[model samples]
Each structure stands twice: as structure tokens, then as C-alpha cells.
Target: MTRPKREPRRPKTVWLDDDQQRAWRQLLALVMELPAALESDLQRTTGLTTFEYLVLANLSEADDRTLRMSELAARANSSLSRLSHVVRRLSDNGLVIKSVCADDGRVSVVELTKAGMRRVATAAPLHVAKVRELVVEPLTKAELIGLGRAAEAITDRIADSG
Candidate 1:
């Protein structure tokens, strides 16, 4: 049998006030646009989504190109379940491996495969260029610094509240 459809959220309950609306729209646009743009570039050049690339990049930079699954999830801005799903895909692609952590039997760690390292090395420059083209070059150096600070502040706020 088919499942019943879920009801949609009512607009009045979810809608934002004027200032919140403006901020929400701008934030939403950045949220949607930035990932799509970066992911497209990554996909075009390295055949990976931004999320996948982030997974590899984080692993590659970690000591031994590895991290505990729970930690990797946090660093990659993904949930443990989502990270597991992605890691499974990466494992299938032979770009990452998951196994029991030596220090903690209950935990798993993810490590970059040699192929994943090579892929990230090849993709990093092109990804950086795309970032410059879409985000960095348009701003003054001061604005760039401010952008970093603002992003960190927002991240902290989100983390605190979340």
C-alpha cells in the first residue's frame, strides 16, 4: 500500500517578519547559490560534489588522513547518519575507507584512500579558483576578512543554538 502524503507547513507559522525576511532571503540565496556554484565547479573538474570534496579534503588534511566518524561528521557539517551514507558511497568509489577505531572499539574512523588524496590535490586549485571567481575577487581584502569573521560568528551562533 502507498503511504499517506504529509501536510505542508503553513506559511503564517513559518513566515518571517520584514527584517527577518530580508536576512532570511539573503542568507537563503547565499546558502543555495554558494554550494551550487562550488559543487558545480568541483563536479566539473573532480567529479565530486562539494560535500564529497569536503569529506576528502578534511580527511586528507587530518593526521594520517583520517578522523573518527563522529568527529568527521562535525567537521564536515553533516550528521553522523548522513556522513555514514556519504562514507558508504565514498567507500564504494574506493576513495575512503571505514573501519573500527583502534583506540575505541565502539567508534569508527574514516581514512582517505590514495585515490582520494590524489583527487583532492587535483581539485583544490580549481576549487580555490572558483571560490575566487565567485566570492573572493569581488570583495576588498578588508571585506574578505570581514566575511570570514562574519561567517565564523554565524557559525558559532548556529552551533550554540543548534
Candidate 2:
């Protein structure tokens, strides 16, 4: 029996109106510039990349300063492979240790070392100051709340689509 042929799909185009175009442009500029500025500040002060800091910070916030490798990658917004590499580097530096989960041998877990805790503790104040200087200090309370809501909405949309 012959299979039926499927119809070709039409590509949909979204053309932004003037206000939307302006908003998109501003968001685009922010997406391009903000990370670089933050990364530069982090690298200059702590010799840690933004990703490294994120990994450390997320681990610090976790219960017992430990998380499964997969969970850490999601929290860090990193790929599993990338997280593995970063974890290896951190291990080499004595910042974190990775071991097989006691309950599940197939699962890998990462725990922040005492040294990692100390490193993050040292970096936190400087990072917070930089964040205030670059992002928070200039915004009014209402604007900050609006920004947070906007970010949450956008992230929700992205997460739903993906």
C-alpha cells in the first residue's frame, strides 16, 4: 500500500508594529550587552566566568549544598555536557566534588566543597555590588517589579514552547 503525501507547511511571518519594534530593539540590545558586562565584571573581580558563578550560586542555595548533576545543569542553564566539564574543572580546583549518588548509582551528584562555599561567600558581596551598580540601583521599585514580571512572563513562554 502507498502512503498518502503530506501537504507542505506555510511559514508564518510576524511583523512587529512600531512600538513593538522599539521594544524588541531595546530587548535585543539588552540581551546582547548585559551578559558581556556582567561577565567582564565577574572575570575581573573573581576570575570566575558567569557560568561558574551561576553553578556555585545555585549549589549554595540547594539543600545541603548538593544537587544531582541534571538538576544542577537545569538550574545553571547549562547543558549536561557543559555542566560535566565545569564540574570537572571545579573539582580540579577543589571547589566542588562529584560522586555517584548513594541511592542511585546511575545518578551523579555534585556537592560544593567547604572551599567552594568560601569562594562563593567571598564573591557574593562583590557580585551583589556590581549588580546593584549596573542593574538594580538605577531602577525604581515599581520598574524593578515590572522588570521581574516581564522576565517571568517571557521565561514562562519560552519554557512552554520548548
Candidate 3:
């Protein structure tokens, strides 16, 4: 006689316990509020949105103050289309220049103009002050290190999955 067929196994659902739930809620609040706070400060002080500042800052740090459009998008944590729009605006404002790469005619590159560097230089101190006030000052050194490790782990997991 043949044995009966085994049913497919269902995946286990791991629900958060009360303490875990509380911690998750706290994290959720930070995730929602932190970016808004940073954006507000940056916008008010620098007339640049957080994303725009990120794009400018990345270019400022890059070799020759230039980066490929795709690389800049990844560094800025933005989509290519979004970066294209932002670059267009920056180009219009004379803060950045986009051109075909000399080495690779097919690829586009963005260069931070002297004006772009000046913009970031003016903005960096204010952004750093806001970051210190909102994030660093409140945390003890140990807590700050732990937070960095946790962020790294989460980012690594996300990158791996994606």
C-alpha cells in the first residue's frame, strides 16, 4: 500500500512580542520623523532639499568633483530618473554641469561647478549642526556605535536581498 501524500508545509509567522512591539514602534517613529526634521532644517537653512544636498555633496567628494550619472544616483540613494530631473534643475541654476563622458561617449557625467562647491560648503556646517543636535548629542558613544552597527546590518540585508 502507498503511503499518504504529505501536505506542503506552511511558513512560520513570527509575531513580535510586547517588548519587541514597543521597540519596533519606537524605531518606526524615528524612521518617520528623522528625515522630516532633517529636511526641514536643510531646506530652511540652505534652500536645498535633502536629496539635492546629497547629490551635491557626493559630487563634491568625488574625484574632480565629477561622477557618472548612475553612480551619483546610487550614492544619493535616488532613482536615475529622479537624479536626471534634479541634475537638470542644478544645471539650470548653474550649480552643476552634465556632459557626455570623454572616455565613454555613451555615459553621462555630472560635474560640480565652483558654485556647486560653494553651495555645499555653505550648507555642510548647518547640516552637521542639525545632525549633531538631533542624533549624535542625544546618544552616548556606545549607543552611537551600536546604532551604526545596527544600521549597517539592516542595510547589508536589504542590499543582499535586492
Q: Which prediction has the highest lDDT against the true structure?
A: 3
Q: Which stretches of candidate 2 lie over 4 Å from their true place?
A: 1-14
Residue-level lDDT for 104 in candidate 1: 89
Best by TM-score: 3
Give one digit per residue, the lDDT tens place, for model 2 in 34-149.
89999999999998998999999999999999999999999988899999999999999999999999999999999999999999998889999999998899999999999999
Q: RMSD in angstroms, candidate 2?
A: 3.0
Candidate 1 RMSD computed on C-alpha atoms after optimal superposition onto the true structure: 6.9
* Backbone clashes counted, model 2: 0
**lDDT tens per residue, model 3, 37-91:** 9999999999999999999999999999999999999898889999999999999
TM-score of each: 0.82, 0.91, 0.92
Consecutive 10-residue window with the lowest summed lDDT within model 2: 6-15
TM-score of 1: 0.82
Off by over 4 Å in 1: 1-24
Model 2 vs. true fold: TM: 0.91
Model 2: lDDT to the true structure: 0.95
Cα error, candidate 3, residue 68 (Å): 0.7
Clashing pairs in 2: none
lDDT of 1 by residue, 1-162 (tens): 999999987676666799999987988899899988888778988898888989999999999999999899989989999999999999999999999999989999999999989988999999999999989999999999998998999989998998
